[model samples]
Target: MSLFKKFPFKDKPSTAAITCIHILDEKKTILYVSHDADDGCWQFLCGKEHNIEDSRVVSLQQIYEIDKSIKKIANLEYGKCAYRKYKNSKWNVQ
Candidate 1:
């Protein structure tokens, strides 16, 4: 028997998971959010919609619980950042 018969995924993923990012200001106000599917290459706050079997809320709540009260800014926030995502299925794709 072929292992393909026992596994759901074939050689590659059949769907692509989509996510959005929202950035907040000093007053916890959302300044920018992802508007399109290919809106990358910017100082963005990341967020993802999880599929948990619970409440009827489709879109997962994103609360950036960070202690932004400290006024700590010398020259920059960080050094390098790599933008990547995990493997998962799409929203409405089988």
Candidate 2:
């Protein structure tokens, strides 16, 4: 059984596990990775969860490669509805 199977949102077989982190700097600026440099859109560092571990190794590794000084301020997970909204409104903005 998958570790996330206990979570309410994990009931759907197609529900992908995503690890997201809010990276903050000393100046209080939030880090967002752009889909394309010229696209003028940005979002937090996130990765698909493929393992049972909670360390979010893949997402953390991507973030650390960008800036070692960036600290994790928050960790959040969105349900289907909220995630859809985010993907449509925030993430898809160009």
Candidate 3:
């Protein structure tokens, strides 16, 4: 059986997404997620700011590997954002 529930987002598993390189750091976790309304692009990020070079384009599935809790925000509305204080914290949509 799968460790996590299947993704609920409309985007495909191979869909391109923008994520901060910090997400690759062992000590860092994805605390924020955004679904742009204008272009319907997805962005996964840590709560803090990062340099332009810190950004990376990765498949949505790759991100799911980093933090499966993100599945909770898959249905988040366009133009909205979701954030949480910690990896295990409940996500708060904004």
lDDT agreement with native, every candidate: 0.24, 0.30, 0.86
Sliding window of 10 residues with minimal summed lDDT for model 3: 1-10
lDDT of candidate 3 at residue 22, scale 0 to 100: 84
The TM-score, computed over Cα atoms with residue i paired to residue i, of candidate 3 is 0.88
CA deviation > 4 Å runs, candidate 3: 1-5
* Residue-wise C-alpha lDDT for candidate 3, range 35-65, written one tens digit per residue: 9999989999988878999889999988887
Q: Write the per-residue lDDT of candidate 1 for residues 1-94, one digit (tens) a residue.
A: 7533432322122222223322223332322222122432122233333243211211212222221211111111233222323212111110
Top TM-score hit: 3
What's the candidate order when arranged by decreasing TM-score? Answer: 3, 2, 1
lDDT for each residue of candidate 2 in 1-94, tens digit (9 for 90 to 100):
7634422321232322223433322222222333223432223343333233422223333443444332222122221111213222332222
Tally clashing residue pairs in candidate 1: 0
Global lDDT for candidate 1? Answer: 0.24
Say which candidate scores most in lDDT.
3
Give candidates' CA RMSD values in order: 18.4, 13.5, 2.5
**Clashing residue pairs in candidate 1, if any?**
none
lDDT preference between candidates 2 and 3, better one? 3
The TM-score of predicted model 2 comes to: 0.19
TM-score per prediction, in order, is: 0.16, 0.19, 0.88
